[model samples]
Target: MKGFFDEVRANLRSPVLLAAWGFMTAMMALAGPFGSYEQIALPRRLIVWLGLTALAIVLATAVRVVVYSRWQLRDFWRGGTVTSALSVAILAPVLRHMAEVAGDAYLIVPPGLVEIAGFVFCLTMGFCAFRHALETVPPAAARAALPMAPADPALPRLADRLPEGLRAPVLRVSGRDHYVEVATAAGVASLLMRFSDALAELDGVDGLQVHRSHWVAARAVAGGGRDGAKMVLRLTDGGQVPVSRTHLAAVQARGWLDQT
Candidate 1:
């Protein structure tokens, strides 16, 4: 139950995703009971409209994410605001017409005024979405971005060293303070990094975090064991990392259960 809620929270926390969902919801509300091109039975209309709304939200979220991936957070938010505003403004007619389908005619607002209102509402929603996205970034992310420890009066400076490219590969990414653990042939190495930055750096890697604190290299697993709802990843070096139930299938699909 807790894990389920965490997943829900993570989805809601994404700005581009959440913003797209909101816009899609508004679009559905405008489509009326049966949808854009139909005047079906009341029950059928409600079900179809709701199903399409859900599908649209998912698709819109995916498109926004793919586009946003190439841009920095700031630029993405700025552009997304403009795009969202424009989309809503243009769709006003479709939405208003849908509202008129239930016997009561929707107020015929001037196009100029409707567009202005949409722009303002979308802008506000977009800004709030961006702010929430930034705020959701964990503090440990900052540490991962810069691995160098600052010079301090009480502690001597030490050279930072990343693990040599070994036979074992990175399993997953998780952040805590200034360290990120990479599951490798040797074992888990808690290196200096914020969790978020480390996750971002895993663009080319083929792995996923099985738990909030554990990442498993895709190719390092020797076997697996289970403990109630928790999972254990057995490595070549006799090391094991716990996998949350949430990521159990992902781990198994990576052949974490197969032994050479």
Candidate 2:
């Protein structure tokens, strides 16, 4: 949960989020819905709308993280929908009251629940769309940016499930009965996912399955040779994985077997 709130606070610093906030705040200030254009002075209206939208964006981020963590929902459109709905449900009434204060109830009827929801949802969706666009970098381009580079929030899909400490270069993935264990410089973590699916998401990661249930990054291979009758690949962490007969040819072609 600590990771969750940390993500929310981090959103405030995003260029995309900041741009979206500024755009929405400016639009709201100009349009002056809820009678704020008539009731409040121009400068105060801008300030009030800026504060309102900022709060909404923060709330939407909190809702987004909670939903994803709990339901594992990651679809772009579906996530935006859930985020807007849940956010409106949580913040609409508060916004309506605030809008009334800004609009001055004595002069105008403020804004109804439905009207406030529409305005909030529109701004939230705008923020989400901008964030998604920024994160949609091409896989090849992403790979060109090496692990030594500063940590990118848009890591490989598999990294999303890893603990924060394990964000280093992924060393390997080993499949057990029902989960895949991922190894990184910091440590190892297990994710409840298919071994094949795990390997598929690791595009441009420069690795291959050395056996039916084991994949190793080229950079992580210390060497390879026979441990008794079984051919094995030694890892940087002093761990070893058996190289199966099915993948022996590929491993040999890559010259990994000669590294030892």
Candidate 3:
């Protein structure tokens, strides 16, 4: 299906993320086989070791994503490297065990502590390499959608108060006592009037009510910022509005990125 293909494209586009995952997996597999499996069949040992290692790697990636979502390249690199190193250290024995099943003899290291420490050191090195690779790849910028123009003749006339170049067809109107908030390309504003009265007096736009207090033009959003768990949209002329989590996916799908 078209949707499935689109999803595939999106996944394929994340080269850095994919590379990180791949390297983690390879390290796990290599180290796990080296550390375990004298007691079990090679196949079973391999499966158990690989599966556990993969899970650890995935968990590491998830943790990094959550903690570093907004981090700059320098920070992200440092964190990711640290994460990779710790992950490798933790998973090394498992990898060594798997490798043992394949008939490779591990060094008879003492107390297992030294092996773990070695894992930590190797992991750090691997992650550092990954970060160095990312230096060549630039991150994508954020963007947001803009509102559509309104129709009705009276709406344009009402919007006429704005500069000629700033005029956009009114999409929706809402009331705050005597003032009506209009969603236009120029930005939202309060004009003295009942929102319902203004809607009836306007024409030619299609949009939906976001809430009782606000109606966003279908395209007026440019991008947004996060305030803890909340998303704040930065509109034209530097005005900001909150986009509820309930509507966040919609905003993301519309490709709104903060320009401010």
Candidate 4:
């Protein structure tokens, strides 16, 4: 349920979604499927169109939440089809009600047919928007190919800061508020140490701070990829670390970016 709301929030903030809604509103006003385009005043036409578009978008988002929660379909196209169909089912009656309120009569086609067509058009637009949103580089697959440095028996002083069992080959160190989360070959452990002090203790380990909050071992980096414009590094332990813009040039200079 939390995930569903999160998805809804994300979708609402998407630029592609906003653009789609704008396009739909314009088309609804200009096309005038239920009446002659010039029959209604421009202001009234725009108001009606905007209202209907908002209603449809809200309902479609709700349908997506339900479909995604109830049906865990892995295939993208198949899942989209089912969700779109369900959205249309919820859209039909609301569209009719809005049309009647706006004093528009179904012109060439029945109200039902118009509603179906409108819903289908909206669904197609949504699918395209999502496809654009999902266009991200796959995680780096070359982590295994990278050579690992010799495991030094002399543990870095940073090991003293970790729990006894977690004092192994550190993969990454991430800052979380006042604590630092240390990921190692053994497992993950959190210690209440200042991030700067922790970095000073790891003097012998070959690693770099990739982000304001993240420091990753050079050998642990599997490869790199792009999530939209942001750079990401895949670690041997199957963790993805985001590279901040401030540190991107430094990471690239080390040949880490080329590995992806």
Candidate 5:
């Protein structure tokens, strides 16, 4: 149960989820579906829409917790789709009941059908919005455990900082709170070194710091793309590195942005 609440808190903390809620609220206010626009004042309609959004988020979070705990479905889209469907299923009927209790007029369709259709439509919109948000938000930094690389007599200083087995071609280095996560062809390892110090060790390496917390090898960059307002460099290892606003122009100047 504690884990369930923790997951819910994490979801709610997501900027993407919050943005979706705001967008859905505005759309509901304008569309006035379920006779909400005509039956209530603007302020009340906004409040009701906000309440519905909150309920949907909570229900979806709970459903996600169950799906993940019992079924072990970890894929983002798959879990989100299930949660969205369940949320709509539960939210639609509850909304209809609320409308009846409040004595609000039904829209063009019967109250039950109207609530179902309206909630489904809004949820769909929210899902897409959240998906886009996920694309833009940077992933959490973590090092993957893998076997070490073969010994190289001429290993660089940066390679020295890594563990014995992980001395392979560097892909990228991402800064955690107090550690630097070094990604290589062999695997990943976290070293207790400042990000700036790590970059200094790679003095002769061909790479650049794209973000405050991220530095990527020039050879490791396979392509690039736009994620909302940010530019992302796709690494050879299938990792995406976000380029901060401060270094966007520098990345573009270096032709990294032209790859994709």
Candidate 6:
């Protein structure tokens, strides 16, 4: 929840989103689409549209954050597409009902579901495309580091998933689509499986699930990588993984920080 809310706060701070919402609200109010023009006066229309859209945006943001944060979605750009589709499917009908109540308390049937859904789908897709087009990089990392620990004997289950050459000790496991990318002393290999399944194979591994999408072996963590306000766990094999706030307490409890 902390990670989700933190993402929401960052998104809400975007000036581009604020401008878009304002413009969209003004357009909806002035044009009075659906049956709104006949049922509402201009002042009332402004208030209704503003409030409705505000609520719509909040719900939309929540959906987007959830989708974008999916452990399997390593490609950030692809996440926008999923987010828009999910937002339209989830928010359109709900918003239409809100419109019905705001306009005339369902006294008259609201806009057809198809109509509302189409409008929302187009708007969301456009917003996602525009937003992603401006992105030059992925979201940055988090704070903290890891301490050195030694690995136990390699388990056959995890070893079988990797290529013969790279089946060394697991340094980290990152989720990507239906696969778990296992990083080891040799290299990273993507095993066809869910993140949970990957972790299950390494049950006795001395590591922590520091993020929804990542699991890091304690021995592999080398300290001293920082990205602005965030702390990134540097690995023995020259990799860095961000620690999500949800796992920060556990990271601390494990005495992983080397603030030195």
Q: Cα RMSD to native, each candidate? A: 14.6, 10.8, 16.4, 17.5, 16.4, 14.2
Better of 1 and 6 by TM-score: 6
Question: Which candidate gets the maximum TM-score versus the true structure?
Answer: 2
Model 1, span 1-260: residue lDDT tens: 45334434444565655555566555545554223334444455446556545543443343333333223222334536644554454444554454555433223332344644564356445544654444232344554786644432321111122332221445444454455545443333344566766666555454567777766555556788775676788765455678877887887787775544
Best to worst by TM-score, what's the order? 2, 6, 5, 4, 3, 1
Q: Among all windows of ten consecutive residues in candidate 6, which has the lowest summed lDDT?
A: 135-144
lDDT of 1 at 70: 22
lDDT of each: 0.49, 0.75, 0.51, 0.69, 0.70, 0.70
Question: Among all windows of ten consecutive residues in candidate 5, which has the lowest summed lDDT?
Answer: 135-144
Model 2 weakest lDDT span, ten residues long = 133-142
Show model 5 residue runs off by greater than 4 Å: 68-70, 104-110, 113-118, 121-125, 132-260
Backbone clashes for every candidate come to 8, 0, 36, 1, 2, 6
Query: Local error of candidate 4 at 32, Å?
Result: 2.3
Q: Evaluate candidate 6 by giving its C-alpha RMSD to the native, one decimal.
A: 14.2
User: Candidate 3 — which residues are off by over 4 angstroms?
Assistant: 1-40, 70-77, 85-114, 124-128, 131-135, 138-260
lDDT per residue as tens, model 3, 101-219: 54434334322545655765565556545644443222212111323345336444556433334357664455554556565654434454656656554444554344344545555
* Shift in Å, residue 251, candidate 4: 32
Best by lDDT: 2
TM-score of each: 0.32, 0.57, 0.34, 0.44, 0.46, 0.50
Clashes of 5: 2
Better of 1 and 4 by lDDT: 4
Segments in model 6 whose C-alpha atoms lie over 4 Å from true places: 71-77, 100-109, 136-260
